[model samples]
Target chain A: MRGRLRRGLLLLVLVGYAAIVVLAAWRHEIRPGWLDAPGAVARGLLAWAGIPPGVAVFTADSASAAEAKIVDLCLEVRVVEADGRVVRLHPDAGERCPAPQPRIWVKGEEIWLDRSAVSLRAAVAARRQELRRGQSARATRLLAEALAAHFRARAHAEGLAPERYALLWAESRVDTNTGERSERDVALMRWGPVGEGDLRVSWRPDASLLESHWPALETP
Target chain B: MSDGSSSYTGQGVLERWLLGPVSLQVMVLNRIVLGGVLFLHAASRAFELPRLYGEAGATWSPAYRAWVDAVLAPDLAAPLLALVAALAELSPEMREVVVIGLYTVLLGSSLAFASGLFTRGAGVVAVVLHMLFVTIHPFAHYGWASLVSPLVLYVVLSRAGDHLSIDAWRRRRRGLAPLPAEAPAWPMRLLQIHIAAMYFHTGFARIDDPLWLEGQALFEALARTLFTRFTFELHVWSPLLVLLTWAVFLLEPLAAIFLWVPRLRTLCALALIAMHVVLEILTNVGWWNFIMIAGLLAFLPPPWVARALPGPVPASR
Candidate 1:
């Protein structure tokens, strides 16, 4: 009787675990609209247990979405010193300030700053889309502030003392059919005085400050 | 009792198939490969730990803070916030020390797990630490957290350290006999089923999408500047791209089914491996193709694995 009970319990546990795995795959990968409520509950439970269910739809990018347009976003930073001297920080300015590279020999080989830049650009683009749909622009502003804080932390790490830092968000668009490319500086975000968290965002940034890095930004 | 064939029916067959004794060699191989891959993945991120997770990073960014506030339940958020508050209370230097210390321990655990030193304990610690990091910054590491976490958990549950491990070697050195080279088959069965489910879902989910159905998905992926490793004038090779896309469309779902067939198992596994290899060459997906290939190795017959491995052969069931 004891042996039978033990086997029964083990079988029950195995069945329960299998059910959970199957349900997770169904909820996350299959993602049926009717199962949204159950999916959310499952996600909540998993998150509560500190297990991320992972990304839904692996390698499932929409080709239509990719073909729609190509947008390349870049970040440009300038440091203002207390003595009225301005120092421009290049994205490729050595190990201290690294930016995302278009081509890498292997995936996941980029440094932390480059990865962070990729995340920031993606977040900004998502927030911008939501803003265009009449949603609140708070998220976009929050992302800008996050970028400011990141650069501030990076500057501090590099032992740079600056009165203020100006951040410019630039965009490069490629006409796929005609093979023509254009570039413009879109917005600016500022963070100041080296140790504080004050951030300001402006939609109209100085276009003249946008460097002629079009060839560098080309897709090929 | 004249013939055991009478016993192989209904639930008994399934019970025997799943819970029956099997060589632990495959599990041991899986544990080593999975653990090593995980270690490398973690080590790859080690260089930028301070910049990514420390006082100098977005770990405390307002967006992350807001996400924690909105996404996590109050019960879950409170303790996490309290811990963060405690960390914040530390001096900048002290905080960095704490962050680096935890990261170092995480790396150590992954290495220990791979080396099969205190296998279960190390595996558990590795999974927990990896999950903690993933929970804190889900955006930074993509796909890998979800794919590897459960596999590690399964490895921890299995008796993978029964052979080819330091634990086993130490037992012999201590004048004790080695444990049996076989364990219950449930863990391997679980891995196979889970992988099949993944392929089934991913493949079938694309059925409704016109891009995939029309064979333009690969074309679009290759043309995209964000994902593709290099630019190709995709129009020139549109026909080949479409053929490959259809091949993937059919192979994925079919493999999910045919992998279970004894005669076709090796063929299915090889085809899937080839697909992953092609994907790795064409795209910038990190460790995904490699992880899938590692999982696919489980589908190869135990006899084949035993043949490939060196040393004295264990008797088959």
Candidate 2:
């Protein structure tokens, strides 16, 4: 082929590639989005006409509405406990808590905040009994705001970039039988051992081989 | 970038790079460049003090290590034992001599691979040692992390030393052949395929992640070194940079396709090269990516490289 024609052909292929990405983006998709389809195309092309390389990678999308709902629930809890008596219970907070030792994603140090950490839970329930507890209502609003910020901050610090992380966090539904010591499934970067009492940490949730080693907790 | 044929009025830049249809010499350079990459990589494993003890210890692992050794026993043993020839071969010799002697054999094996001298022997030795080391630390890293051995091991088997090595020198003295006169092309193409797999799989695995989707992947990557690059310790996000991130994100697989397409092969070569250049500036991917990107030039027509070779060896020679 002539040099000019080859260049033009090259231009056409590049333009075609850019056009496909643009179209995919417009159609609510992008590279690694419609991964299966192009993979199929590439695979078929290769199988029938021989591919240079045989390996390929795959991907999928996940939802975040469930997480947002949970965050909303936490906010509700904050509202339910506002203006209650000072539960000045334990400033000992986490000083006596066991050291967190997650089994996975150990890039740096990590700590966990349990549901029981809410030293004010039962106290608020008692004060919330009165019909016109005006001061307690305001306390509820403050609690809601703090909890919301805590979850968001946790998500961000875990190296989760907003959207997917928030959704996945909510996906990890926190559950308990008698509420004695309920656990929250937390996957984050840490630098040490995660004991049985500490938070659960698993990075590649999809890889069963790995996840099984550091099994993530979940509620049915 | 459009300078493919845009008139070189003075210095002859085009003549130096676009060597018209792929040539035999281009193929040799392709193999040599590939050799440099293989040698450098193997050199690390060979030189690493920590890995030596670690892999040597694994040879005694009661678990799967023994099984792997049983299968490739001979291939897995000789050079590895040679690596441990650390025992003073000559007691009369100085400790520095021992160090230098071990290093000489190690370096010679690497150079043999790099220069394609007795490459099959060198390459085999390289793989055997690599297998032994990795088998021990299979927990420390994954097989994907050591992806190059199988690819260059292909070169060693193809008798790459026949053209570009001291082995080739020995061959020349024996009066067998003038190195076939035409370069074999499939091995390079095979290599290009291998690298494309690495990039595609890497990108594919991270596709669903929010950072890659929002184009913050590159930003986070830049952020690792962001605190130092600027005078002000700044964190500014630009819409334009994000758009560029998306552009490159979509380009890797596209470049792979272009490299395969014969008509646009040169264009693809340049695009991929530029991609690596940008990657080099933005990340610390090491010579792995850069060398692979440069080596992708093989897909271009030989004439492209034909135009690229020097007019003469230069009278200084």
Candidate DockQ values, in order, are 0.06, 0.03
- iRMS per model, in Å, is 15.6, 20.3
lDDT, residue A82, model 1:
66
Query: How many angstroms is residue B257 displaced in model 2 relative to the true structure, after the best TM-score fit?
Result: 2.6
Off by over 4 Å in 2: A1-220, B1-27, B41-106, B135-145, B173-177, B225-234, B237-240, B306-317
Segments of candidate 1 deviating more than 4 angstroms: A27-220, B1-6, B67-92, B307-317
CAPRI-wise, candidate 2 is: incorrect
How big is the positional error of residue B264 in model 2, measured in Å on the Cα after superposition? 3.2
Give a tens-digit lDDT track for model 1, residues B95-155: 7898788778788988888878899999988877776666555546656566787788777
Q: Model 2, residue A46: displacement in angstroms?
A: 34
TM-score of chain A of each: 0.39, 0.24
- Second chain TM-score per prediction? 0.88, 0.63
